[model samples]
Target: MNTTTLASTTRLNPVSRPLPVLLAMEDDAEDVGRLSPDDRLTCHVHGRWIHQCVASPLHVNPITRHRWCRSCATALTVSVDELSGAVTMSCPRCGHGASAASARLIVACRASLVAARRGSGARAA
Candidate 1:
């Protein structure tokens, strides 16, 4: 990865969740804002579903350009800027960058994002 891409890629902690689940969980209904108690529960359930979906391995083939995680069945699109050493993954819902090894860290960040959204949403609602 180029320095710029590397810089853009968020560094994850040593232990963290997977990215998609984190993202989905972060944006759960309650976090999005103005949800009722039932909506909050529904959102939590949805997030749990997403978490299960992200807890598996992804498959990739260099020759076929076929890459996807078995759990979520989401397509994997990667962008590498040769000049800048930036490697980004356009996740199903959002785009974030980091070295492959940083995947765990990215996931952790997403969890935090979910917490942030929930906090803000609670205040807004």
Candidate 2:
């Protein structure tokens, strides 16, 4: 998308100004692979909540094992509570998907949940 499209979408209401960092991330250098999942949650991209997109194939990392279950050879399942904003990442096969990356992601997801619910200025398009 061009600058024009991005400019239009970041507008939450007529009187509001766009936040410096919460704008669209579609042009974010292709999926923001290097960006932390938590930071990805704070930005408006894909028009979905953090929990909605956290389990995407893009998040799977076999080498670093960010969300990988080495023994099961599968990506971990993500569960998030909407009201309570609880995030869970467990292997679907053996329930052994725990890692430093997943822990960081969980924290980010919870914070994102809070922001999504409380911040009127950071709505996704």
Candidate 3:
């Protein structure tokens, strides 16, 4: 019987090992704005997209016209239905509409969602 250590096994099949691919930082300004809405690659505000900046969920306040959920008094999560292209913001706890300022945000979110679905199909091909 023979026993091989985990480290030894890794060394024997280096080519079979999966390599971690890091996303390169985008530098071209022209390409940055060209990103589709659903493209999480770059943020509209920041020149480069940082996960923390773009990934954080949004909230909305009807009275204040700000990002806040007054019914639940907490931040709201934005949900996108990829199939129907419907973007909605609601109180996570109470299921109430949080803000009237959602019109612009909703439009942007819908466009992004649709773009993402289309992009995925292209990549698969």
Give the per-residue lDDT of model 1 (tens digit) for 1-125: 12222112222222233444434543553344432221121123334322222222342322333334334445555543333434344446434322343343234334434433454455566
TM-score of 1: 0.22
What lDDT does candidate 3 reach at residue 50?
Answer: 24
Q: List the pairs of residues colliding in candidate 1.
A: 1-85, 2-84, 2-85, 5-86, 9-97, 12-105, 26-114
Model 1 residue runs over 4 Å out of place are 1-71, 94-125
Which scores higher on TM-score, 1 or 3?
Answer: 3
Every model's TM-score: 0.22, 0.62, 0.42
lDDT of all predictions: 0.35, 0.60, 0.42
Separately for all candidates shown, the number of backbone clashes (residues 3 or more apart, or on different chains) is 7, 0, 4
Total backbone clashes of model 1? 7
